[model samples]
Target chain A: MNKKIKTYYLLTAFTIFMFGFSYMLVPIYEVFCEITGLNGKTGSINSTLVIEKPVERFVRVQFTSNVINSAPFKFSPGKKEMVIQPGKIYTTFYTLTNQSNQPLLATANPSITPGKYAEYFKKIECFCFTHQQINANETKELAVQFIVDKKLPSEATSLVLAYTMFDITKQLGYKLEK
Target chain B: MNTDADHLHEDHKTGIMRWITTTNHKDIGTLYLFLSLTMFFVGGAMALIIRAELFQPGLQLVNPDFFNQMTTMHALIMIFGALMPALVGLANWQIPLMIGAPDMALPRLNNWSFWILPFALGMLGSTLFFEGGAPAAGWTLYPPLVLQGGDALPYAIFSIHLLGLSSILGAINIIATILNMRAPGMTLMKMPMFVWTWLITAFLLIAVMPVLAGAVTMLLTDRFFGTSFFTASGGGDPVMFQHIFWFFGHPEVYILILPAFGVISTIIPTFSRKKLFGYDSMVYATASIALLSFIVWAHHMFTVGMPLAGEIFFMMTTMLIAVPTGVKVFNWIATMWKGSMTFETPMLFSLAFIVLFTIGGFSGLMMAITPVDFQYHDTYFIVAHFHYVLVPGSVFAVIAAVYFWLPKWTGKMYDETLGKTHFWLTTIFVNITFFPQHFVGLAGMPRRIPDYAVQFTDFNAISTIGSFGFGIAQILFLYILYKTLKQDVTADNKVWEGAEGLEWTLPSPPPYHSFEEPPKVE
Candidate 1:
């Protein structure tokens, strides 16, 4: 081939090779993404929290808690201090005793902030955030199981969990801190 | 025909201004190719920016709105700018040769079609730098949201109008040329596959361009006037807009792929050293695909809460299409079977096309299942599926056609080693970019999101890097094109030993006006 013809062939060959090479690269990169999760981090709940508690309760019981920086608390019991590690679920129990001479009623209410994120993290089975009636001198224990997000930043070290016990008769609420 | 006599007397000059002013089919084809090349680079650059943004997640390179614009424009550019124009380029260059016509039936109309594209794309691209940026509501342009765009909306809408007009005119010109300008002995059956494919494709264009024109015009009126074509509050159903749009849109897909089919049909037989298998069946299959396209519009709208009966009707019809498509595929394989196959660049690309496009077709079948589509809809999986079809399917066919015909067009042979190198690199990188998208979609990642939850970060990063590699690979294509035009390589009248068609009967770099005396056909 003449110099001009040689150049033409070289150029045409180069163009075809480039398109073919690019075509092959698509699947390889796909496999890399699946293996590395470099595109996005993937995590599933290592453990789920299960809680068992009695419905009726009486007495002024306060719940409060703090979470360590590495672990972000997803839930808390009414006015009790609890500690848990990241990637691990922990459960705590609290008992309330009715001391009034007559029948006494009490209830626990739960709520969270950053509402959208809370919707995904917080779990409740029933309408248990309302008041419950109890006979005088009755006793009950409330329990909750919860997991902290391991993906939480280390800078967010301490998380506050607070709960209040309310007397339905007097419309009085008591706060608990831990 | 008398058109040949007229073509002979037309002024054919040899300078740059001649190319700019010329109405000859050959000159217009050259113009279309050059224009599409420029747009290809422009669109490729936008895609690179999108990949860069997804490289590490978060708002790193651009804000969400701008990111959306990049994605939307990237799609529009590749589909409209790159694929459509390239096919038109091929049509301009090959249709007359295939039909044994001296020139296009309406040469001025051909020039009009070729000239309008630049202005249309210019208007569309200018919106990116304008106040409030380009149309960021994705290329689908679903109403209520698209109406919310600022100054860019009118520009984008008008640009679409121009593009539609250009396509309509081009279609009209093709129809006239094919119907009126065939060689004396050429009957419909005797016409080459490329010409037949374009004849059907052009009819489809005439039928649907008006629908698109009408739909977009209504959109313009809905935005600016008190018209309520798409506004839900105005008693017009928003869902109806999708119906009208996809009515034009589904056939639009066939419009893009059929010419590609024609190109591949021509290339595969030539390289395999065999006459095309089932020539009549191929013709019938093209017609079937085009006709089925009209009814399958509702498949795209299955998720929009259509009635069960409508869904089933559209679903079955869409699935039925696979039959004709399968016929085409089987015919291609049968053509290559037991033939003396050569591993030329064109043949290599054609072989890759058969395998890869079938994968695209299979995924499309999966989408045809309404229940399955619900899960895959609006996800990265859809992205992966279409790219497989468009990139390796239509786009690769165009490249193959270019390689197959470049020697004849330029009268020079291109470098084989570099061609193979480019091919291997592109084929590898393309899959890396789109394949992982399937996994990400299955993993619940949505499409069109600028940032994703941390879980999706890993795959997104890999896809992004792969995209960069794929984008840069096209530079090699440009280099090769430049080299071919600049060189003076000698080529025989029949560029490939197995090549058949009236085009090969002419000299290398065929005359501006060919077939002054139409040759006898057997």
Candidate 2:
């Protein structure tokens, strides 16, 4: 009987451990992404990898921008495309207009087409990494400074950097109403 | 120690109150079975509604959104509510009796596990009344889309948590009872296949159910607590949700079917008048299948865009599962190879389970070829694959078990003619309903859509008619069960001529506390 009770306790403890392991997968998944670069999740550039010799090759980078339907904003790329030499820095901007009557808090999410280029597409400075607040009917320009790594795979000739802007204000507005 | 017959009068109550308050394993088992049967009808109704809408294609019975809700709710109720609970119900009744134990190791916990289900199901069923209707994101509950759903999301999450808790507790009790409460000298290897299958299944429940709990908890936090666990915009990956979900979801498929293996293992041998051909190998095969279940989860996500290496690894592992599964099937066939055979409802169901489940298995193999899955993913072919496994594989086995054991359970004979009729109708209609799905899927009709291209019209109509036929057959099943319960043509201890097991040693309609004094096994 005592043994049975002890086994029960042990099994219960194992269940609790599994509960912890479920949460542990969050960090585990992040680490796995960092290692495999799966899902186009990018890693921050450190000076250590920048020591590679620059290549003379040029890659055409096109910019695409759009706003979600529920988010009352107009967004477009300042320039449609730019040709940059591999291992060189390039700068671009996107124009945003708040079409709503109230102030809007917007955040931009970035994705690179073909996915393989996401790891090599390094952002030195970008509005996507920060939050922007625009007054009612206000227009604003956001800058994105980036570098194409020398290690960008040889088969990658072109890339599309797409940014989708979400209005957090309206998202939170529904919450406040609730 | 009192013999079972001597203790027949031991304060056993007979009424609704007895069911509500009783801690006896048998009472709890009965509760679980009745609840599961009720849910089977409810889920089946939802399936019929889905078929009715999809019958002629373009928005026939329901709009697209409500149609999505029906598909989603139908899966949830049938998998969690009907099939799982029924297996657990069978385990509760059979395990103790088969092992020569008086009752489960933890009776009160057993009662608690059974009782939590009704409330969980109530919470789940009530989601249909919510403003957005019940969880239109399908049972996968993938985020971003799922997050857009209204009040039903939270209710669905809560119900899942309750259901997971119930299954976990039930698993713990089964483990404890099997490990600690076995009759002296029965020995681990000597234990019956049903007990062995359930023993492994309990471990599976313990392992993966918590992962499901974890996944749903993350979803809950993401929805209500402003956490970004699955919000890709906030440094979280939405695909990670699929990874975690199928981690639980893959094994969940096995949890639904392994008991069916046990049921078939038992029935095949009895009808063949032989001991199971490869008893030891069957045990090893079950363990192998359980072990392989963990590594092969990503097969379900083949179309989710995994890396080539990850795809190859998952594809290989998924294909590897067929080996042990084939072992189980081969052993069943070998058991019935040359022995004297009979075709009762249970035996017929087992025979069909082997052939049809193999077809499902072959389709699963086709999907395992990573490139092939690209075409089959999210199509009716995928739907046909799982339904074949689940309906003929798991659900058929459950019905077979009930029919096989009904005489013992009720101490009366079910009408043989009616039983065989139910069996034949179910077999034919089940095939009719699901087989055409393969053609429609290969023709590229995506699932969960209420409206479809006119090209899919013919097959969809045939499938719907088949579903209605299958639905009517179950009503006959319900009537058969009812008639058996109401009448009392006393059954003998060994209900079948060739039956052999600890369970067959007991009186028909086993005493309220079976094996009050544990039987000594040779």
Candidate 3:
């Protein structure tokens, strides 16, 4: 009977340990995803690359903007498309107007098309990394500084950089007038 | 320990409190069985609703959103609510008796484990009435779409947590009982196939149930706590959820079916009137299948656009599972080769299980080839493949086990003519319902949709009618079970003539305190 009770406790402890281990899988999976870019999760770099000479090959980079249906905002890219040399820095702008009666908190999620090139598309600066607040009828121009790595896969001649904006005012406990 | 004193002291308790507070294994086994039966009907009703709605192609019965909810909830209820609990009920009733143990190693925990199920299932079932009408994200509960689910998501998550806890506790009890409570001289290899299969299953449960718990917990926090573990806006990847989920999900499919393998293995030998041929190999085959289950999870995700190398690797590993699975099927056939055989209800189910489960296996092989899966993925073909394995493979085995053990448990013989009639009705109807799904799927009928293109209407109508027939046959099953219980005719101690086990040595409806002296095995 004592042995049985002891084994029972051992199993209980193992179960608890496993419960904690499950939380750990999140970070472990994140690390794996980052390392492999397994799900097109783009990586951030701390230092800027010095490409002494930009690549001569031109890739067509297109900008696309969308707002979730519930989000009361008008958003669009300043330019629809551009042809640029790889390894050279490029700047693009997006315009956002708060269409609601009150202030709103929002965030943008960025995705790259031909997902294989997401790892090579380095963002030196982007508004997607932080939350932005806009008051009633307020408008803002957001800047994105980026460069396509010369190592971007040759198959991806045309890349679409898309950002989807979402309204988070409700989750943060702000009221939206009906 | 005096056996007669223990029996008198234990059996005197009456009323609901006896069930609520009792620590006896048999009472808990009865509790588990009854709970599973109630859930079986609940889940079955959900299936009928799905079949009814899918009967026509023009969205006549339900909106697409509600249709998605029914499909999602139906799977959750059937897999977690009905099939798993039934197997646990069988384990609770038969494991101690077969191994000559007085009771499970942790009897109090056994009581707790069985009791947790109703609350979990209750919480899960309550989701249908929630403001969003239940979780519309499929049972896999992939994120982003699942993240968009309304009020039911948290309840679903909590219910899954409770269910995971119940399974983990049940598994611990099964492992402890099998390892420490076996009669003297019954080596691991010498244990009954049911016990062997369950032991492996418990380990699989222990290893994977926590993983499922973790996945759901992440979803809970992501949905409620503003965490972005799966939210792309917060730099988290949604596909990560699939990897974590199928890691648990693939083993879970095996978890559902391996015990069925044990049941089929037991029934085949008894009806063949021979020792199970290749017992050692069967044991090894079961273990290998469990191990193989872990790596092949990605076969379900072949359409996720994984690299060719990854796809090829997963495809190869998934196909390799056929080897051990084939070994199990061949051994069952070889056991029946040149042996005197009887076609009783149990044997009939087992024979059907071999042929039909192999067909499901071959379909699985078809999908494992990465290129072909592009056509079959998320189609009714995939649905047909798994249902063939689960409905006939797992569900049929559960029914076969009930018929096989009803005599022993009830101390009265079930009506054999009715039993055979129910078996035939079920076998034919089950095939009719699922077999046409393959054709419709091949004809490009996508799953989880309420409406379909007109071209696929004929097969869907046939499948729905077959489902209704299948559903009606089960009502007959319930009536037969009730009728058997009401009869006063007692069963023979050895109910099946060739059935040999420590369980058979005891009386029909074995005593309250079985194997009080711990009988020795040769």
Candidate 4:
């Protein structure tokens, strides 16, 4: 009887452990991504690598900026387009204005197309790497320092660097309405 | 132990109160089975509605959104409500009897587990009445889209949580009972196959039910608590929900079917008048299938854009499942290879299970190739593959089990003629309904859409007619049940000559309280 009761307790404990493990899968997935270069894929790069190397190969890099619908913010690229040599650093500024009364936190998610060029298009320093908090009625200039590595394929002629601004205030526990 | 308090409690066994408060294994088993039957029709009605809408190129019976609800509800009520509870009902009745134990290890918890289901299903059904109607995100309830649903979302999530909790508790009780309450000298290897299959299934429930609960809880938090577990802007990827969900989802597939394997294993040997071929192997194969279920989850997400290596790995593991599953199928065939055979309703169902489930298996294999699945994904082919396995595989086996054991449970034989008639109609219509879905799927009609291109009209009409045929045929089953309850022929203790096991030795319509002192098995 005693042994039977103990087995019940042990099985109950195992059930609880599995419940917690389901939540743990989030971090576990992130770690798996890390091991597999999920964080490295088109995310960030060493600026010194870009500053030290220079190549004569030039690629047309176009910038497109947009914000989520009803996000109450005006956003655009300071320069709509540019052509830069591979392995050469270039800076582009994005202007963001908070059009609402409440201070808002937004994250600019970056995408590059044709998507295969993502690995070569590195963002050495970009406002997109972190969340940007804009005070009410505030305007901000966010700069992106990026380089196309020399390994970019020769046939690739054009790349679009697109940014979509997502309002993250409620998600971050800021307790504020967007 | 027969004190006055016990006697008073025993009196509760007769009236409506008996069902509400009793904890007896057989009574609870009956309750589970009845719930299964009721929910099967309920879910089946939702299926008919889905078919009615999809009967032609344009919407007919319901609007698009409501049509989506029908598909979602049909899957939920069928998988969680109908098939799962039926298996649990079988376990509640058969496990203790097979092992010579008096009852389950935890009776009160067993009662609680059974009771929670009705309320949970009720809450989920009420979601249809919510201001915007029930969740129509399909059963996967993928986020971003699912979050857009109105008042029904929270209710649906809560109902899922309750269902998960109920299954988990039921699993714990089954595990404890199997581990601790076996009759002396029965030995683990000597136990019946149905019991063995359920023992593994219970563990699966324990392992994955919590995971499902956690997944739904995360959905709730993402919806209400402002957590970003599935929100991209909150540094969370919505695809991660799929990963977590299928982690539970794939095993959930096995959880539905493994017991059907047990039921078939139990039925085939009796009707064949032979010992099961490779009994030990059947045990090992079931375990192998369970172990493999965990790693092969990503097969469902092949079209979801996984990394190339991940796709290759998932495809390989998914293909590997065919090996053990093939082992189980071949063993059943070998058991029936050259023995005196009977085509009783149960035996017929089991045979059909082998043939049709293999077809489902073959289609699953077709979808296992990453590139192939990209084409088959979310199409009628996906619907056809799972329905073949689920309807013919799991649902058929449950029907077989009930027929195989009905005489034993009622102390009266059901009308074999009517039984076989029910079997034939069901078999014929089930094929008519699901077979066209394969061609429709390969023809590239996506699922969950209320209407389709006119080019796809013929097959969809045929499928709908088949579904209604299948639907009406079920009424005969209800008639057969009603006749059985009004039984005139009393069944003998050993109902079938080839029957083996402690359950057969016991008198038909086993004592309300049985094996109280435990039978010694050697």
Worst 10 residues of 4 chain B by lDDT: B1-10
What are the per-residue Cα lDDT tens digits for candidate 2 across B198-277? 99999999898899899988988887776789875555678889999998999899999999999999999999999998
* Candidate 1 structure quality by residue, lDDT tens digits, B158-265: 998888878877877787778877888899998889888999998787777666766777788888774666653333445666777788889998999999999999
DockQ of 3: 0.52
TM-score of chain A of each: 0.42, 0.86, 0.88, 0.73
User: TM-score winner among the candidates?
Assistant: 2
TM-scores across all candidates? Answer: 0.74, 0.95, 0.95, 0.92
Candidate 3 ranges beyond 4 A from true positions:
A46-48, A51-60, A81-88, A148-159, A173-178, B3-12
lDDT of model 3 at position B2? 84
Question: How do the residues A23-121 of candidate 3 rate in per-residue lDDT, one tens digit apiece?
Answer: 787889777656666665565754555477976788999999989866899999999999988878889899999998888887898888766677888
lDDT order, best first, reads: 4, 2, 3, 1
True contacts kept of 1: 0.00
| Candidate 2 chain B worst ten-residue window by lDDT | B1-10
Chain B of candidate 3 versus the native chain B: what TM-score? Answer: 0.98
lDDT of 4 by residue, B49-80 (tens): 99988888886779888998888888999988
Question: Residue B260 of model 3: what lDDT?
Answer: 98
Give the whole-model CA lDDT for all candidates, comma-separated.
0.75, 0.89, 0.88, 0.89
Q: Residues B298-410, candidate 3, lDDT per residue (tens digit)?
A: 88898887777789999999999999999999999999998899989988998999989989999999999999999999999999999999999999899999999989987
Better of 2 and 3 by lDDT: 2
